[model samples]
Structures are given as structure tokens and as C-alpha cells.
Target: MLKESTELSMILVQNRQQQLNGNKRLFAWALVLLLFLGACSPKTRVLKSPDHRGGNVGGTIPKEEKPEGVDKEKTVEDARRAEAARNSVALILPFQLDKISPRTLLKEDVNRSAIALDFYQGFQLGLDELAQEGRSFSLNVVDSRDSEVRNQYVAKSEEISNAALIVGPVFPKEITSFGTHLSNKNVLQVNPLAATRAREFNLPNLVSLTPSIDVHTKAMAERVARDYKTGDVVIIYNTSDNDGRQFLNGFLSELRKVNSSAQVRSVSSVPQLNEEISLTGTNLIVAGTTDRFQLRSFVSNLEAKSSQEYYVFRVYGHPLWERIDFSIYERFGDFRPIITAESHLKTWTREAKEFKENYYSLYGVSPSDHSYKGYDAARYFGNLLAKYGDNYPEHITKEKFEGLFSAYMFDYNESWGFVNKAVSFKSYQGSSFQLN
Candidate 1:
């Protein structure tokens, strides 16, 4: 990863040096980036703090330029637009082949063979697709070993001279570091994971690809208000993770928005399902965890009370929902529960399918949350490199792109969380997920 970053730095520096002879296009785009998104930070500062922000407020403003010919003006506008439409991104994951750790992910034959790399695989597919479209950008990738070492690596790896952006380092600590000290020069950190652990709420430069858990919770609450009107809403969660906090916050916020007087309850221990008394009136259960202890408890409790009148709503606080060992239909036993899945995956791309199939075939299993998420991160970053070309003189403007497993959009909020935010309902009909 260090070597790759260093190589990229050399290339970017060379480009700038070559362009100093008078490359107006590159200079113009640089001005746009430096002006709108605070891209003017010194290269050393950018490296130290990849999540740096507080600039680029002016990029959204329109600047009219009149050129010689009608054809020339149109060409200039198109070029600028193209630069704006595309930019580079980075995806830091656990894929450092040199250093291997069992705790790192995909270590076991089952997970390694299949699951842990799905997201990256899908992300790679997106890269190939972008190349086909003739848009290319450079992608900086690193593996955090899912540990503090990765944090140190990220903290110091900001030396990439002209990197446009970064997409990951899946852990929140890493994200927080980037946010707290965005030292990357002329580059932005596009966090695709680390959704729940965001301590810094709004950094203008860092962009989160996942929708805030708050968004999901609020959306679910709104839906219930629209459909159920008034009822019993229960939120089940693993109190251990901070991710639960966001979900609860969002859910509670929405409940008040829809009906300030709505009743709310939170439970951490699944075994305490017994504590949950009386299913009178409209009953709604929302579990904020994907823990086996909770899922099993939920399954047993729900099944035992299959005859009760209630609505089972499972809110996947994150991809943790996928780790569940229980089958939705069997656990609920004919009960139709609404499953909320948050993904940045584009879902319907040729490359996505290929990646999925290849992943399953290679590992003899389906891709795990870590794999698919990591893969998407990589592909998204790669797509940026493809679009910007080798010169990278043009500053990329924010625009939405259709990713393999989800749609990604970036705003100045600096939290990539929203880029992957889309809520879709999945009903388990005893066997498979049926979209309603």
C-alpha cells in the first residue's frame, strides 16, 4: 500500500511539473477544486488529515466563461462538466496480502474462499464498467487489518501528493482519525464504511457513502406512521455497539416527528424477550442487532408467540444484519416482518452479478458483509481513477454514480454514510426475500 501510494505521488507530482509549462485546463480545474472544496490544503496537511474539510464552499457557484467560437465555448463547458461529473476515490480495506491475520477477515476457508471479499469484488466490477465508459481515475487502496495498525498507517499515509480522494479504512476509528486530522494534500476521504462510529458529525470535506442510521430509523418510523398510524413500536438492539445509538436516535426522532406522543421501548438482552409483556394494541418490534444471541431469542420468542397479533420489523443497523444465523421466515414462523437493508451497492449491474457469482464459486459460499462492502469501496475508488485519467489535473466535482450494489452520492456533509443510503423493504416468505 505504501509503495502504491508513493508511486501515485510521483506520477501526480510529475503531471503538475509537466503542466507548469502552461496547462490552462489543469490549472483551471485546480482552481475550481481549491476554491470550492478546500482542496487548497498543502499536500503535507492532506496526508496527515485525509478527512480535512471547511473549504470548497464556492464550487457550487456558476462561473461563465466566453470563448472564441461557439464550438470552442461548448467544448470548454463540456470539459468542465466532465471534470465535475467525475473524480477519484480510495478504498482502504483488509486486503493487504503481505500481512495476514486470522482476525483480519476472510481467513477461514469458508469466509476467505467466499464472503469477506464480496464488496471489493463488486467495487472492482464498477471500475471495469467505468473504464468501458472511457472514464478513468486512480484508486488508492489499503488494508487496516481491522486494527490500530491500520489507523497508524492511515494517519501517516497521507503523503500521496495529488490524490483526489479516499473511500475507506472500514473501521470508525480510522474514519474519525481522518475526520479529526484530514492531512491529505489536495485529496478527500470518501468513507464507504465506518457509518456508526462517526464522532465528528459534519466535516465539510469528508463524504460518507452509507446513509446515517438516523436516516433509516426515521424513514422506518415515518413508514409506520403512514401505514400503521398508531401502534406499539419496540426497538431491539445490542447495547454494546454505538451503531445502536444512531438507530435509536433516528427512530426516536422520527417517532416524535410523526407522533410526539408515541410510546417507545428499548431492550438489549434478547433473553429478556420475556420482559416484553403484553402485545395489546398495535405491536411493532424493531431489533437493532444482528447478534445470534438476540436473533435466536427473537426467533424463539416470536415463534412461541406466533399466534399473537404484531408486526415484526427488523432494522439492519448496518450489514451486521447479514451475520444473523436465524432464517427470517422460520424465526418469525409465518409472521411477515419488514427487513430494512442499507446498501451502497448498485444492485443491478452486470459486473456486480459477475463478482457475486465469482465470489461464491471461489469460496463455495456467499460473500460476507465485509467482503461485499470492501469490494464496493474498492470499485468506487477505482471508478474515480478511471474517470479522471492519468493527468488528474482537473478537479472532480460531486456527482452521483450508480454502483454495483448501491447508488452513491456525495455532499459536503463529509460523511460517506448517506451515499449508500437507500431503504428497501424485504419480506421473508418462508424461504427467500420478496421485495414488497
Candidate 2:
């Protein structure tokens, strides 16, 4: 009887094991179905049809035969009208939905998905606003999957090929790869997030929304040059990596351009930096490092040294410093640190307040920086597309926009495409950074 009981227990354990395996398989299938549905849902709004043309729905005008010797200007105008009638925009982002798993999922995966979702939602809201304003658009959202192979495939797809405006494929590598594939196309591809220099990509049809590090350096340098006095000392503390050194070089170049006679000292060590700080005239110190740890140590040391000697100084920091939390350093405020900011959202403004309320009501959460970025890109580019049609690229530099997060003033480069040169300076004061 005891032997029989043991055999019965083993059988029951085997049955339970099989049941668990079956449940896992069910869960995996369910997750995949949910992801597929999510992709086709209103959030993505992917237009589908049984027709061979893939249901373009953008109201593209059919080409009509024209007799020889038709006026060229009239032909062009007709083409523009046709283009205006066809308003299709494609947004390609790294959703990486294919990597989702029931097991072995990581936090980074969730974060990436969240970023994509937030940006998509914000972009949709912007387009929704335009729709209400009578600007019709057929937006096709594509997932790049953050893979080069996937990006290349998407870039060559019919939807992307026909888009009036294409925004994203987010990261620098993906942008370059995708843009390279579409080099022959006349479509303007906006680099939505990467702050990498425009010249690096050399894509003539690219529009970079994020201000490059060089732009930040130049802005800070100009500000420093403007504030320079005869008695004031200019110093650079540069214990940075190659990327950071590029910023330092750019800053120095711009500073020299404005004030060729300006005497600036460069120091690497803490003791050397301390020796240059003066108690008399204002000491303008540039913290030329992108390293957050180094920045914290440097700021802490400066604060300690300043307190000990009552040094009167102004600290000009790298753009990356904007992301570092200096609130922990009690004396960081005393230095009056200034950093170049690309996005300055005035939350107190009526427009900003309304946007926040509307966004919260729609998404049940506050908008992230990416959300603001996506909204501005959609609104700015959508308006341009609606206004100028196929020739919107010609008018890109002519238009200036002030959105919730950023002010856009584009300068066209023959080699590097369009660069957003608008940058704002923020000074740390009264426990918070404010526009200066």
C-alpha cells in the first residue's frame, strides 16, 4: 500500500509539471496577441486595407496627362496642390516590441517601451490638434525595433517611401542607417532625439531637432565672452574624455572668435584650478567635462574652496551638467552655475498649464521630456507640411516656432542638412535653475 501511495504522488507531480508548462505556453501566446493588437490599436493607428495600394488614405491625387508646352510654373503649382492634398507622415521609433518575453524581461526593456509609447501619444495629440484645425493627415507609425536590420527594412518599406515627413528611428546609429537607405528620396527625415553633431551623419535631407553639443558650447562661450571684463579671470577645468574635450575645443574657439584678446587659463588638477580663483574680480570658470561623477567632485571641491576663501566666481558648466543633481551640494548655488539648455518649458504659462491638464486627462500621467519633444516636432512639422506641401523643405529655415519645450530656429547646411541653433541659458538661483 505504501509503494502504491509513492507511485500515486509521483504521477500527481508529473501532471502538475505538465500543467505549469501548458500555462506558460498559454501566457506567451496571449502576450504576443496583446502586443499585435496593441500595435494595430488607436494608439498606433496603423491604416490597413485589402487593396494592393495598402490603403494610403492620404488622398493622393492621381497624375493627369498634360499636353506639351504646358506652362512650367502652372505645372509646378499643380504638383504642389497635389502634394498638399496628400498629407501622409511616418513616425519610426524604437519600440523593440519583438523582444518582449514572459520571462527574462528587464527594466530597460520596459523603459524603452515607455519612451516609445509616451512619444507616440504626444505626437498623436499634436496631430489631433492639427486635425481639429482642419489639417488632415494620414500618420503611419512604424516600430524600428532598435535593430539596424529592422531599421533598414522599415526605411525601404512603401509607407516610409511615400511619407511627406518622416520623424525618427531615434538613436544616432539607427538614424544614420535609416537615412542612408533613403538618401535618394527627397523626404525630410527629422532626427528627433540624438544630440550628436549634424556633420557626423552628413545626410542632406536630415533635420536635427536637438541642439548639438557644439551648439551648447558656442552659446556658453558667447555668453562668457559677452560677460567678460578686463579684471575678470577666465579659467577652464578640463579633465574630460574625448567627447568632452571636443566641447572644450568648440567653446574655446567660439570664445576666441568673440574676444581674441581674452586671456583664458586651462587647468586639469584640483590644486591648479584652486590657484586661479580670485577673491577680487569675478572668476569665470568653465567646467568642461561630460562626466557626472567628475562634475560632482569638481563642484564639491569648488564649493569647499570658495567657502574657505570667500571666492567670488561664476561656474559655466557643460550641457550634461543640466542632468546632474546639484541640490545635494549645499554650496553649489553659491557658485551661480550656468548651463546651456535645449528645452525650457515654462510650466506656469497658460498654454503650458492647459497642455498639462489635457495630457493628464488623455494619458492619465504627466508628459515626459520625450512627450514634449514629440509634440513640438509634430506640431511644427505638421504645420509646415500643411502650409507648404511638398516644398516644405524650402520654407523650413523661414519658419520659427516656440513650443512648450523648445524654440526652433533652423539653419540649413548643404553638407549636414538643417540644424536647430536655438539654445537657452539657465542659471542656478534660489535652489532652482531658471532661464537667464
Give each model's whole-structure lDDT.
0.48, 0.75
Q: Which 10 successive residues of model 1 have the least lDDT summed?
A: 42-51
Candidate 2, position 23, lDDT: 47
Query: Tens-digit lDDT track for model 1 on 152-218?
Result: 6565655333455665555576566555555653455566655562325454455566666665776
* Clashing residue pairs in candidate 2 (N, C-alpha, C atoms within 3 angstroms): none
- Model 1: lDDT equals 0.48
- Residue 75's lDDT in candidate 2: 61
lDDT of 1 at 202: 53
